[model samples]
Target chain A: MSTKSRKRMLPWFPGSGAFVDADTAVAAPDTLARVTEDQRLTNDGEVTVASPDTLARDTSEREFATEQWQEVIDRKLVDWGRNPQQLEYEELIPPTRFAIQSAAAIAMLCRDHALAPPMRVVPDGDGGIILERWKGSLSTSIEVARDGTVEVVVVEDCRVVSRQVLSLE
Target chain B: MTSGDGSEPIDKDEIVLRRIPATFEWYNPGLGKPIAWVAFKPNENDRSGISVWRRKYRPPCEVAARNAKPGRRYYVLGLRVALLRAIGITVEPSPLEGGPGHANLVNLSSDAYRRDKDGITQLAKIIAERLTICVDGPFGPFDIDARQE
Candidate 1:
C-alpha cells in the first residue's frame, strides 16, 4: 500500500506497522504518514469496525485479548456507574455512560486493526474513560472525554509525536 | 515578579511539584524507569488548570501535607517553570486557603487549542519527558485502593 489519495487515514497506532503521524513519519520515513482530521475522519467506531473490508478475518482467535480488555471497561461501569462518587480514595468522579461507551468503541477500533491489547482502561476521574496500549517505548492512549469526544495521543520515550481528536457524536 | 498585567508572573526559574495519579504512574520497561505520560494531563474538572506547588514556596517534602491520605501512596514529579513557558504555558502562584503554595499551570492564550485536547496531550508528553522525581517520593503503586484497576 500506497495511501496517498486514500480518504480514510487512520489515527496513528505508532507500531501498528501501518499508520504514523507527520512528525514520526519524518524520523522513520519508511512509515506512511496519515492525513489530518480535516482530511481523515473516523466517525462511528462500530461502523468502521463492521465495514465490509474488515468482515473477512479470523475472529475467533483474535478475540481473546480484546475480550479481556473489554472486561476492564465493563467492570469500571459497574463499580462507579451508580455511585459516581466512591472512586479511588473517594476522590475521583464517576465516568459518564457516554465515556464508557466511547472507550468500548475505541477498543473495537484497536481490535479490528489488530493492535496489541490495552494495558490499562481506567477512568479519567472527570466523568471520562482512558484506554491505553503499550508497545515497548511507544504508548498510545485514547481518551473519551465526558462529552463523547475521542482524543488520541501517542508518546514514544516521553515525546508526544502525534495528537489527534475524533468526534464520536 | 509581575508581568504588568496585574496577574502574578511565575519566574522561569521556579520548579513546579505536582501530585501524580496512582494509576497514571508507571515504570515502563521499554522507556526505562517511571514517568507516565498520563500523570501530566490536566484534569477535566479543573477546566484547564493543573494544580502544582512551587518549590520555593512549599518545597517537595512539605506538599504531601496538603493531599496526604491515611495509607495510600502516590508519586510527585517536578517540571521547571521555564520548560512550560517555552511551550506557551504560564505557571502563576495561586494561594489557596491554608495552602499558600498552590498554583496552577494554565494556558496563556484564551484559544489554547480550543480545548480540543491537542494542547493537554502534547503538553503532558513533554512534561513526562522533563519530569523529575525525588527519592523520598513513592515510586510504585503499592498502596493504591484495592478497588482501583
Candidate 2:
C-alpha cells in the first residue's frame, strides 16, 4: 500500500468500554473520540469526528501513525530484549524468564482491570521486568522482581500514594 | 571518599548525575525520552538502591567520560538532591575507589529492597521528571555520525 492514503482501523473504543488489549488501552483512559467513514478529514488534519456524543481530535500524521507505530515498536522491543547481550547497555541485565512471563500476566491483569496497557514495558535493570503507565501527573509502575514478586506502585505528582507487593494469584 | 553511613549528608541543592542506559524506559532505546520515572530504577545488584554521582565533586562531562565504556556511550542527566529529599528520598554518598562522587539514591525506609522498592522506583520517576540533560543535543543524546556530529 502507498504511504499517503494508508487504510488504518483506528482502535476507537467507547468511553465506557474496557480494553481487551494494549492496542486500545493505550488511548486516553475515559475520553474517546469516535471516527467513521462519513466523518471529514480536513486538510489541517483536524478530524471533527465529534458530536455531543463524540470528542474532538487531531488526526495529524503522527497521531494517526501511532497505532501502527506502537505495534512495530512492541515487536522491536521483543527483538531487543531477547537476550542478555541484546540488552545493549553494559550494566543492563536481561529480564528474567519469569519476569517476562509475569509481564504478560500483568498485561493481562491490566486488561482485566480495564486499565491502560503499559505505556512502556522494559527491563527493570535488576534482571526483572517493569510495566509503566503515565496519566497526566500520575505514574504507575508494576515491577516484577527476578524472583517473581510484583510490586505495584502509584505515584501522583512525584509523591507515592501506594507502594506494596502484590500477590498475583 | 569512603562509604557514607548517613552521618554526613548531601546538601539539598547539590546536583547529582545519573547515567541512563540505552534501554531505559524513557530513553526508549535511543529515542531518549526524558520521562523521569524511568530514569533511576535500582540496579539488580544494588538491591533497591540506585547509583548516582554527586556533581559537586566532579563535572558532568568528566563523569560521563569516566563511566563511558568502549562499544556504547552513556547519557547523563542531572537532578537536584534536595528536590529528591523533598519527597522523602535519600541521597547518600557511598564513594568508591577512583570515583569519589559515587552515591546511592536510597529509599527512606530501612526495608527498602523488599517492601519499599516501589518507593525507590517512584522517586526514580520523580528524579526523571526533574532531570536535566548534561550533554548537548535534542531528544536523544548527541549522535556521533549525525549532523556532522
Candidate 3:
C-alpha cells in the first residue's frame, strides 16, 4: 500500500499496520480500517460481508497496547548502554529475536483476554522472558522460557493465588 | 565517628535490618532495571527527606546470565543498587561525595562486590536495616521474618 493512502486511513483506523495477522483484525470492528487497508492492497481487493457492529471501533485499546509493545521490541535494549555495568563492562546482551517473538505472542494473549499491559517485561538470567502485571496488592507474572513453556503465577496480598504452566511447544 | 565535614557516619549499629519477600513491589523492571537512590531524615521533617529519587544508571535486563561477561556485571550492579535503594541506603552523590567519608558509602557499594566475597550479602544486610528504619507504609519491605535475605 502507498504511504499516502495509509496516512489517509489513519483517522478512521488510528492503528494502521499494528497487527501482522488479518485474522486478528476480524475480531474487532475498530480493526476494519486496517483490515480494509489490507483488503485494499490484496489482489482480490475484497472483504467478505460482516455486520457493521462487528466492524466498529472495538480494538482501539488493543491497538494502543500493540503499539506500546512494538516500541519495546524495536529498541532491542539499546537504551541500557548508559547504566553502570554498561560503563564498566563495555557491553550488554540485547534481547533475543525469540524473546521479542514471545513478547508479541504474550501481548496478543493479553489483548485476547483483556489483560492490561504488564508493569514490567523482564528478561531472566535463564534465556527466558517475563511479563508482570500488578493490581493493588495482587500481582501476576508470566514467564516465557526459551523452551516454549509459559508459567503463570498470581499472587494476592503477597500470597500465591494460583500457579500454572502452559506448553507453547 | 564523624567526617571532617561534621556529618555522622552511616553506623551499622544504627540500622535495623528486616527480611522481606524476594521481590520489590514498587520497582518497574521495564524501566530498564534502574539504579537509583533517595535520601531522607526520619522525624526531622525538614527539606532533607522529601527529595526525589536520583537515577544513576539504567541497565538493560539480560536474556540470561549463564555466561558471565563484562556486560553481565551491569545487570548485577543495577540490581544491587536497586536493592540498596529499596532498603533505604542512599547511592546518590552528595556534598560528602569522594574521599573516605559518607560519600565512600557509594564508592564502597560500587567497589565492594569486586573487593570481597561477602560484599553483596553485607550490602543487602545494610539495606535491609535501613529499610526497617524508613519504610513504614503498607507497601513494605514486608515479609520481615526471612532474616537471611
- The best candidate by DockQ is 2
**DockQ of all candidates, in order?**
0.18, 0.39, 0.05
Pitting candidate 2 against candidate 3, the one with the higher lDDT is 2
Q: Which candidate is the best by TM-score?
A: 1
Deviating ranges (above 4 Å) for candidate 2:
A1-77, A88-90, A105-117, A148-152, A162-169, B1-13, B28-33, B106-111, B131-149
lDDT of 3 at A146: 47
Alpha-carbon local distance difference test for all models:
0.54, 0.53, 0.34
Q: Per-residue lDDT for A20-64 in model 1, tens only?
A: 233222112222212110122232211112333333342432455
TM-scores for all predictions: 0.61, 0.60, 0.36
Candidate 1 error regions (>4 Å): A1-7, A17-64, A67-71, A74-92, A108-114, A134-139, A153-169, B1-13, B23-33, B59-61, B67-72, B96-98, B108-116, B133-136, B139-149
**Residue-wise C-alpha lDDT for candidate 2, range B1-149, written one tens digit per residue:** 24544235688888887766554444543323345454566555554367777877766655555535444445667777767777777778776523477787766322464566556655566566665544311123334432230
True contacts kept of each: 0.25, 0.59, 0.03
The lDDT, on a scale of 0 to 1, for candidate 3 is 0.34
B1-149 in candidate 1: lDDT tens per residue?
21232235567887878765454334233444346555555554454476777777665555544445445455567878877888777777666422466677766222343454555666766666564534236533334333232
> lDDT tens string, model 3, B21-98?
112222233342221111111111211221111212111121112122322221122123344455445543343332
DockQ of 2: 0.39
Off by over 4 Å in 3: A1-60, A76-101, A111-115, B1-149
How would you order the candidates by lDDT, starting with the best? 1, 2, 3
